[model samples]
Target: MRKDSEHPFRQFENDPGRHALVELFVREHCGKIKDLLRDCVPLAKGSFGNILGIRGKAATALGLALKEYPRKYESVIAPFAEQQRLSVNIPSAPRIWGSDQADGKDYVIMDEIPGVNLWALPQLQELPRAARLRIFLDALGIVDQYRKAGKRHNDITPSNLGVDATGDMRSFDPDFMSDLHQSDTDRFENKSVGSPAYMAPEAVINLPAGRGPHSDSFSMGATLIAAITGEILPKLLGENGVNDYFFYMLNTEKMQREIDVMLHEIIKDPVLLKVLLRLLHTDPAQRTVEPELRSELESGAADHRTMRYILDDYSPAYRTAVQQWEERMGMAGEQEGFMRTWLRRTAISCEKLIEFFKGLRNV
Candidate 1:
């Protein structure tokens, strides 16, 4: 039980205008200012607002999170609430209980989704490979839902995601949600409002035609990369690196090389690596849709095939020839075995092998 002063809403106390807005919001939607101050518990804080969880008589049957933002954001928050009201298929998105504007602020009361933030969960490295893949697919599915609804969450970072007890990934804090049906002018007005670390290359530069479903795909790729490697794109590049990658070096061969190096550090599955590279492409048009990516991931083809699986599919003579070639090349070093080197060099080669075997079988 923390004191009222410790609550995130108190941060606005020094500013008279925002302080008045907070008091108004608490009184009108929550209850008496004193009651809210005594019972409200801080949930999360963000650049746009402070989320407080209501308890006791003030809380709804299912519980609620009160988020307060400055009145200036009414244009964004108001529309988001309306969109949530109309949205039916996106269960991962927070359900807004109510929203109102008064004084100099906007307040939205929404369901308190139960879960731990995805970023705060145990490191991906500690989790089994299958679990890591599940997390990526689940997160991508959430993005897919938004895409199907003709909306894009401009901010898709790990902090805005959560995993519940049932292992389902949920998206929250949609302050930057954008409708794809909007005119170009409306879409680009707030193009730059997103987390820089996970922002798409187009959104980073405020490219007017660049912020669309593809941009969300780019952010989703970056988010998954961060979750997988535990290294954010900005931090991996060092100070001023995000700007350099998105602004100065965009669409250059050097940028491609940088992307390759980053992907190679953690991603080994050829299909996954190819998909992520496409998602992180400098050109938004080149990015693939989340549903297609999800389908590819779920199919067993995405899993790295073991030597035994390959051997079973091929002839013994072919395996003997491969062994002979490995022996001749003396490629059995502890650091780099023949198969490991082959897989690293031939990312798409495995696909080619499958095609060749299918051709032979057809013959």
Candidate 2:
């Protein structure tokens, strides 16, 4: 566990002046916040600022994302205020109390949310498989509501997901959130704005492809796999050198059988297994829970396993990318057959994945 003294926001440590600023802000915003300055706890540190938890009058904890940037308070605080204006179905998410700027810094007070981050849990693997499955579903439901409201949660990872005291899932941190209801005129600049470990294949190559709810599905899918298998998806994929093509191939019946064999050692239900496999579809359009996929899920065909993945049905972009890759491989062995080339590529991906996962584990 990280100690409070080791917290990155050292500027606030033993600083009576900063504490006074917090006190002044709370005194002014007493109608919205109900915490004494003495109860504040530095919960986390992010790219922009420190997340402080306040023990308020209510049963639940109140949080504050206090801006610690050198400047640009408007840029840091505006979006969080705008995001708080919107709400999702989840009881503990983006339920922001209010925002205020004082002492040349901005702060957005929100629900501290009970329980620890999913990754920080000491015994995530000890939890029942049913519990793990429910966590992903609940998280997806939250994502669905956000999408319905035309907002996109660009980041979905274990660290970002929180399991409350009652074991209910919660989604927080609207750091890179974008308004889907808005025009795409400014989409180009938001190319890569999420955690790479849970990012979709399209997201890794191009940000625009993953700038929607389907991208969230891809990330959630990876998170679900990790939850059940006691393995981080990126670490697993990196260890195996698995790429987008490998995930795409998992759509095939033969590949499904291979996956089944691999997962036999890890307990999983057939339907849930199919759901996890579907989430990793290389194409963002197919991976996203569109009307058809939603209908399939609603109709209880999640475990049907009849979805055929023919090479001809492959997305043109995916096919072109793979073709270009194969062409590059052809340079190394001009006479290699298609099957041989695929096999070699698969071997290389596995080698790289293993190496990468090993490095991550060490870290």
Candidate 3:
């Protein structure tokens, strides 16, 4: 833990120990996101960057937020990453161990996902189908499961979805990302945790209200479409245009049809197509189905572990963050969509899972 990796601001200069603590603070409740990469992937010790901001204050804020929103956000992702767990074949996160630490601080030891960006893809046409399928299934299962559960990933793009030399595709950007509930006018690290181009219109235009599950659907849609066509998604968009010209590139009759029709046909599976369509709906309210398609996508591949919130107990921190959020830039309750309901439900389920594991007697 070098001090350079925190923000570059001078405020953190005096407390490398605190910065380490802040990172560890987030890491503790987050489990070993770092270890996940170390155990499953490869990495080089990259050069470090400068520290920034007040490490102590940031650590305090994280603690407060965790205490506040623990129940709402715990089950959804690892502390440092956005992730979940479902059936084994579905390829979700793994179940955590040694929870109920009284101190309730789990550290994320893993860094971002391990693999090259799909955007920087290498030749893989000759790769074995089994290898590719592993990546594809893992990503698809999680995407489908969470969407159906009413959660939306703000960023789903080729860059976020990693592909190794084997041509496997897994979402690196997910697991341990931001929580929807804690989002407000407050000041925390502002990452679009979701992707930019892959995000649905609702996700992009969010301000009066936040985006929902469909936003993730759109990202998946774009990613999947790119997978089929083998074209860069960003290349299709124009700087001056608002319309999603990317759909037209599908080169199908459905692409020329209405927006709804276009959405339905983007993928061959009728069940998944419908879920995707609902996720892409402009009106979040009209799109409230738990998007099974995306979840199916993510879970179909790998079963990841849930080590972050469960052992760390950071939900209360999230809840407390609401008070810290900036006054409604008028973003609250501005738009009620099916996604909102789904998100709430998803958060609740995550909480339940944590409680379930927590309630279990010690070994």
Q: Which candidate is the best by lDDT?
A: 1
Q: Candidate 3: lDDT of 244?
A: 50
Task: For each candidate, give its TM-score against the true structure.
Answer: 0.66, 0.57, 0.39
Tell me the RMSD of model 3 versus the true structure: 18.7
Tens digits of lDDT, candidate 3, 285-360: 5444454554554444232122111111223332222222211112223223322332333212444444444544
lDDT by residue for model 1 over 50-76, one digit each (tens)? 887766532422235667788776554
- What is the full ranking by TM-score, best candidate first? 1, 2, 3
Collision count for each candidate, in order: 0, 8, 94
Comparing candidate 1 with candidate 3, which one achieves the higher TM-score? 1
The residue-level lDDT of candidate 3 at 241 comes to: 34
> What is the C-alpha lDDT profile of model 2 across 167-267, one tens digit per residue?
34667676666676432225435443456567666554442344544777877777766765667664554334546544544345544454445544453
How much does each candidate deviate from the true structure in C-alpha RMSD? 22.2, 22.7, 18.7
Question: Candidate 2 clashing pairs?
Answer: 238-353, 239-353, 239-354, 240-350, 240-353, 240-354, 241-349, 241-353
What C-alpha lDDT does candidate 1 achieve relative to the native structure? Answer: 0.58
